[model samples]
Target chain A: MMKILVVDDEPDVRTLFEQRFRREIRSGALAFSFAYSGEEALGYLHEHHSEVVLILSDINMPGMSGLELLRRVRTEPAPPPPPRVMMITAYGDETSRTQALALGADDFLTKPVDFAALKEKLLALPSA
Target chain B: MSALYNFDLLVAGPLCMLIVLALRRFFNLAERLPRWNQALSWVWVPAVLGFGITAAFRYRSTLLDDAYMLWVYAVVVLTLLLLWNYRPARLALLALAPLLLHRLVRFGLDLGNLRLLAPYASLFKGWGNFANLWLIGLVLVARSQKRLLAKEQQQRQQEEQAHQLIATQNAELERLVAERSATLTQQAASLQQALEELQLTQNQLIQAEKMASLGELTAGIAHEIQNPLNFVNNFAEVSAELLEELAEEQAKPSPDTELELELLGDLTQNLQKITQHGQRAASIVRGMLEHSRASTGERSLTDLNALCDEYLRLAYHGLRAKDKAFNATLHTDLAPVLPLVEAVSQDLGRVLLNLLTNAFYAVRQRQQQGGEPGYAPTVQVRTRRVGDEVEVQVQDNGTGIAEAVRQKIFQPFFTTKPTGEGTGLGLSLAHDIIVQGHGGDLTVASQEGRGTTFTVRLPIYSPE
Candidate 1:
């Protein structure tokens, strides 16, 4: 089962994400973890480093935004290199996208989340 | 010592009066002049008249009683009259008093003695007491005219200087105005350039968002269409196998015709399922096409309740297809009797989809945050008639928005969602449609820990 870590400031947004993936979790197709802030997401990563295959993050947040988190994650000399990060934004601009892409984010998604495409992304995820 | 005079009462009195008047005009004009030129002329008038009397005394008439004295008096009075409007006239009049006294005494002492052999003794006697006083008045008039002339010259110079100063100030004011206009023009050009750059940036952002949404949609749309495609693929395989089986059975010989008829009927039923799948694929493609150009569409008398119900299910289904465990229980309190409004049906559906999905996400967020300890996640959608407008309210009892973020929550490119999860255009677009397009309003009221409610109002049948 692939473990996906989702980080955002909004709790309902994260919970709805879990509900979307509940069937996959029940069927043993994917595993899930959630964090409210970038700092918490990092803490989750420190413990569950081996299991996590992908990271989804929100860019605008209090105390260490998603871009900062992405940069920090990239800088660290850790095992299994780094999980493929996909930025999930409710608001997007060229500057944010350029910065995230430069920091090694694998993809970008705008909200009003399209689950079907996300499923394809999950299915297309490298050999985890 | 052979001088003789008889003072004529009329002439002497008039002569004194004229001198008094002359002195008065001189004094008045003295202060008013810049340098007193006209005042000096007053003194000359009296002196010239006195010389005429001296001439008369040397000729046939006496200096005292002759018309020459009267002529002298007349000249003095005329000078005074000429300068009557000047300021120094009072002092000149005071000087004329002593002259008047001398004239009075001479006239009284020598009256009726109209002889040329008038004694010089009387002349000297008559002049002695009043000569100094009368001469002082003469000197004042002279000095006054000099002073008056000088003042006029000084004032003329000052006027010329003032006029020059005013012209210089006008020039400076004009220069300042030109500089300000140029500065404003430069500022306007800079502002225009900035506006153009911003417009280009906005257009690019819109295009990028479209591409992103399209990418997101393709996966879900592919997944949705895949079911039908698979069904078509499977049916063709089954039919091909059936055709092979029938060929072998027919080659053996047709002993039981009823069995063949039953097989034929089953074949016809499979074709219907194939046709159904084809129809479903087309409908999804149509939904996607409708979503492509959201700004351009026709208005219709839309059933708001029905549109909301349908889009709400579609949005939920879209989310559920990706993660089945993302179980958000949706509760609806739709008004049974709702008003139909003139609006773009598809656009209204899009707005409903956006609001419902946001509510779903809000509820899901609460569950993730340990928001309510251990509780079931729920999203509530309610519609009602609020005044003349119909209100569609979507509420979620989730970890609600903070006060700080709530004010700008609906602004374009403002979102709490993860970078890829939202375009932030959803709420802003919804707001524009509800307010500008539909002549209504969209608003939200929320508490941090409790939940949030988004209310949308729609005008009923009122196109204007």
Candidate 2:
């Protein structure tokens, strides 16, 4: 099973993702772990560094932004083929996209993310 | 008396004295005469006395007969010469008074000898010579007094003329000073006006820069809000679908079917509400996205009237969200069958948003100021197609612009709103989007305390 970590400040986002990918979860193909903030996401990574294959994080948050989290995750020593980071932001400007990419983000997504497209992108990822 | 002495001394003595007096008085030769009148008088006194003695001897050789009369005539002439510069007439009169008193006394002492003394005076021409001398002295005194008066009058007139000239020059100088002062004041006022205009232009440029950055920020906020809204809507939809699947399962003649259906029914109702509200939120975010989108300066055919109507409602609702107490009636008179205008729809929508927003703000401001009874705060939007142009007008029956600031209302960053409430760049940017970018015209008409109307005319075919 692929373990994915979702980080966001809004609590509803966690429930939303779970409901959205419920079928995959029940089929034992996908497992979702949620962290309410960047720090909490980092803490989760510390305990299950090898198990988490992907991290989907929102850029705008109270403590430790998504970019900062991406930086830390990219540098962290982990098992072979480290977890991929996708930075999600409300702003869809070129500057933010460039900065997020420069900071080692594997993908950048804007708000009201197209889940259908995101699902295809995730499904195409190599087996964890 | 001897004939030679009588003829020579008697005539010659008087002739010499008369000649000297004539040179001093007439012929304008007084300047040539010597200033030694006293010395001249002494010379004449001795010559007249010697001539009188000779005449006395000629008149009576034996015993000095008529000698007393001769002495009297000599003494009188000497007295006249001594008083030359002093107006001799006055001196002669003063001497005559004393001489008359003496004569009266002598007449009292020798009244019988009066006849004999009188005959000797006849030889000297006594009273007649005195009268002639007195008359000449009076004329000289009158002429001298007249000359003094004439000189004084001439001096006084010259002083008066100089005073008059100075007064005229003083008046002219004051007028010039006043005129120059007025001109200087006008120049200063114009300079101050120019300075104020420059400051306003600087403020507008700063505001324009701020608006550009704000547009970028809005794009960011739109994307951010859209994500959550999408998630919310998608989750609700999925939950609804899950609930339907569970409902179909419960209807499959399963045990406890009645209880299960009731529970599922309640869940479905809750999920429906969520879906409805989430869609509503999504629409709002989309509207904001349209407003904040970057200008691409592309033209497209658009239904301008419908566009105006839609933005009018959005701006009114937006204001209501920000201010709960704000309320106003919006009236729209969009023309049916309006020709589509070739322009950037997104930029045009922003222009409508700005105009309608300003209109709503105006009416709301009037409502706050406690308007007249039955005064309904209203914003009226109208659209029309005339010739090859489409027109959009936004009017407010609120606090109209004052006459003084009417010309400046379209200027960038020239807002009347209080600081922090407005950036004063809305109209300026809207003008740029419509007129500069779209090849259109934006104009305004207003009456202070009555109402204001902003009209935007866009060409059907933009002359790119």
Candidate 3:
């Protein structure tokens, strides 16, 4: 199963992600972990870095920004391969997109994310 | 006998002419002397010549004696005329009067035929000569007196002219002083008007700054509204999908009852989320509208805790929108039971927002400086009910204000922010709203490099 970690300040993101991926989870094709902030996501990665194949994070949060998280995740020592990171932001401006890309973010998404498009992107990824 | 007559004619005629010349020259009476009076003075000359001729021929004619008596009458009339016309010649006229009197007395004696008084006639002749000498001395004295009188008149005229000149100068000086005073009064009036205009311009600038701050909040408000909108749309769309799935399960000839229940339950949850998020968006819009609306200056009961929370979040989000990387830990220690405060909500909200913004700004600035290792910027907002007063405190662990700057912080146009970033009216207007508008107090405590705290205290019951 593909394990995906979702990081967002809003608690409702967990419910939405879980509901959207119910079919994949029941079929034993996908599993998900949720974190409420950049700091929490980093803590989760420290313990289960090998299990998390991908991380999707909201850019604007209280403590640390998604771009900073992406930079730390890219630089910090981890197992053989680092988890791919995708940034989500309500602003979705060109500056943030370029900065996120420069900081080694694998993908960028805007708010009110299209689940179908996200599903297709997730399906296209190489399965573990 | 002829020698005495000739000697008398020479002495008397010359004496009368000399008296006339002295009156004309010394008293300046010639211009005023009448033609008849001048002719009378020349009559003496003819009389003297006639008497000399008669005596030379030894002619004892009565006509010559009568002519001598008429000459004496002419001398008396001329002296009277001089006295009447010129007041200064009165002394000279008095001397001439004695001589004329002496002549009249001698003629009277001769007319009366007093041969027994012939010795006395010699005595009368001696008296007449003394009278002539006395007239000469008096005339000389009169001329000197007239000279002194003319000098006194000239000195009086000079003094009067000088007095007139002084009066003219004094009037001119008074007029000049009045004119200068009028100009000064006009200048002062214009200065007062200019000061009023400046005050009006300052008020306009303050209003503009208020609108500008609202404009700055628009971005944060947009972000806030957008977040809930995203949630609403997503939930609605997900709910639709769940409804379709439930419809499909119901359409099956033999659908699984448990699966149908699960789909129905998810649909219910999605619908609830959609409603929740829609309400969230609505509340944010309402708050923004209230903030941007023009103040009506109306008072209402307000919940201080809720007001503080709302403003603190708005300020944080607003700063985050401007600087995406900025972040701070916000702690709220609001009283559980706070009495409603009677206040103009809009004005009070503005004051709270300004204080929170400043606290965030201070923390952000310290964060950027990166002065201390392992330093975490924190801002704490606390509200408490202290007896009859409600206190709201905004504290930040950031760069503290200096003592010199703190003293003038509430004065208008005093700012530490860079130009174009701040209008400098925020704190001053906040102070005014708290102290003047609401009859409250705003106080600040700070230590350099430590932190800053701004406290706002409002009476539970307004004194107004």
**TM-score of every model?**
0.47, 0.44, 0.79
Superposed by TM-score, candidate 2 places the C-alpha of residue B397 at a distance from the truth, in angstroms, of 48
> Clash pairs of candidate 3?
none
Q: In model 2 chain B, where is the ten-residue run with the lowest total lDDT?
A: B60-69
- Which residue window of length 10 is worst by lDDT in model 3 chain B? B61-70
Can you tell me which runs of candidate 3 are displaced by over 4 Å? A18-30, B1-162, B254-294, B462-464
Off by over 4 Å in 2: A60-62, A89-110, A123-128, B1-135, B191-217, B243-247, B255-464
Model 3: DockQ score: 0.54
* Candidates by DockQ, descending order: 3, 2, 1
Q: TM-score of the second chain in each model?
A: 0.55, 0.43, 0.75
Better of 2 and 3 by TM-score: 3
Question: Please, what are the lDDT tens digits per residue for candidate 1 over residues B265-323?
Answer: 65675587678778767866776676666457678898877666655555554654454
* Candidate 1 local lDDT, A13-81, one digit each (tens): 543455455457668888778898888999888887767888989775544568878987888766885
Query: Please, what are the lDDT tens digits per residue for candidate 2 over residues A2-56?
Result: 8899998767676567656766776888899999877899999998858899999
- Global Cα lDDT for candidate 2: 0.68
Instruction: Please state the CAPRI-style docking class of candidate 1.
Output: incorrect
- Residue B454 of model 1: what lDDT? 91
Clashing pairs in 2: A90-B224, A111-B227, A112-B226, A112-B227, B1-B58
Deviation in angstroms for B82 in model 1? 24
On residues B211-244, what C-alpha lDDT tens digit does candidate 2 reach at each position? 6434433533443445546656676666676676
- The regions of model 1 sitting more than 4 angstroms off are A1-128, B1-147, B185-216, B246-262, B301-342, B370-397, B402-414, B417-424, B439-464
Provide the clashing-pair count of each candidate structure.
Answer: 69, 5, 0
The prediction achieving the highest TM-score against the true structure is 3
